[model samples]
Target: MRLSLLDRSRTRAGRPDAAALEATVARAEHAERVGYDRFWVAEHHAVPGIASGTPAVLLAAIGARTSRIRIGSGGVMLPLHQPLVVAEQFLVLDALHPGRVDLGLGRSVGFTPPVRRALRRDVEAAESFEDDLDELRGYLDGTGPVTARPATGRVVPTHLLATGRGIEVAARHGLPVVVGGPVLDSDELPDLLRRYRRDFRPHRDSTPWVTISLDVTVADDDATARDLALPEAWALAVSRQTGEFPPLEPKEAIRGAERPAQVRRRVDASLDRAVAGGPATVRRRLDALADRTGADELMASTSTYDREALLASDRSLRDLVA
Candidate 1:
């Protein structure tokens, strides 16, 4: 199976935010060295834990640093930007990087109510995502009402970051679907994907594709790998209670802090959902996931406070799946 990465440019508790972007670029370089197929970044506006709010801007930097591996968003939220503008940004990326660019679009709005208001988007704005995706595809394919600039007649591959409803949109548009979160655990997942493949309409030779994304961390042992995953899991747990996702704290710091029972339970649940262990353990779980979903690719969205450890996990994951 194809192995890819989704780096969110996660910030650390004590480091400057700029460091996270630099770290993301450094991680992309490492991903190429480790034989990863694609090194994708994410967009998370006004979130304290995530330094990258703009995928295109960060992708340009990543492209300049690496030549072989594909670099793209994992993804850019369509509800917050004009379809034409989004097309232009990615068209420019394709202009510079050529065949190495992929456009992964998601329908997520801003992180919080304040962030949504800041972006001038309400919950209802997401209702336009399907239309926006259709319009965006038109611009990308040079069939829109007006041509998007730098339209070099190159088609940048678009993948939809999807759940059930989003998967239906992808099928209707004949685009690949990237699935994660609750849908992956649902008992109805097989039926959902079967329907997606069955209903997919062909657009410009497009075919049904599925990519499964989730957090994956590897280390010398199961305990160590789970420790590396703790920071991200804790950040997620805290976000639920406080509604603000903070920077990744050291695992030591997380363990040292006092927490309420609710926070502890949330943290345990988050960890349980993540795939983190020794090589054998991770491979077993991943193989089971692949058999269950028939996924075409595995996109690991793993992060840790220790940069070296994160890089090691990336290399180990590549070795396991390559």
Candidate 2:
């Protein structure tokens, strides 16, 4: 399977956002050296742990630092921005990077009520995602209601960060999809993936390409790997309980922190869904998931408190997968 990187640009508990962003660029360069297919950055708003609020800006930096690996937004939330501006930003990336840019879009709202209000986006805003996608597609296809300048003339491959209705929308539009989260690790996801493939209708000269993405960290042993994976799992867990995604803390800190019973359950659930182990263990789990879903690529989203250890896990996973 093709391998790629999906960076959240995560901030450690004490580190500044700039450090996390620099880590992203450094990690992307490392990923390219280690034979990763593409490097996709995320977009998150008001999440202290995730510093990637503007994917286009982050991607431009990543693109400037890496010459070989494809770089793009793991997604730009389509409902959050105007179609024309989104198209133009990506087209600018295309102009700068030539044939090595990917445009992945998602339909998601800000993480909190205040954040949503700040964006002037409500939960209902998601309903217009389809319309926004059509406009973005039109711009890329050179049939937009208004010109998007260089974007109208240049071609950029697009993918959808999807699940549920999002998958159907992507299938209808014939865009490739990246699916992950706990759903991918479960038995039910294969059915959804199969249905997407069966229903997919190519929008142009294209075929469906599915990239399975989830948290992964491989170390010399199972315990160590799980340790490296703890930061991300803890972040997800707290996000569920407190309704805010926080930064990564050391594994020891997380293990000792006091959480309410319900929060503990959520934390355990978050930990359970991720794949973390030694090389052989990770490979086996990844192989099963890919085989079951027929994934074309593996987009790994791994982060931890120690940057060096995280990079080590990445290198180990890279060699093992390769």
Top of the candidates by lDDT: 1
lDDT for each candidate structure = 0.93, 0.86
* Span of 10 residues, lowest total lDDT, candidate 2: 180-189
The TM-scores, one per candidate, come to 0.98, 0.96
Report the lDDT tens digits of candidate 1 across residue range 33-79. 98999999999999999999999999999999999999989999999
In model 1, the Cα lDDT at residue 15 comes to: 95
Pairs of residues clashing in candidate 2? none
> How much is the lDDT of residue 268 in candidate 2?
70
lDDT of 2 by residue, 1-322 (tens): 8888899999998888899999999999899898888889999998888888999999999899989899988889988898999999998889899999999999888777899999998988889888889889888878888877675356789999985667778888899998865466556777888888899998878898898888888899988887787778778878887778899999889889987788777767766678899888888998887778888999988888999998888889889888
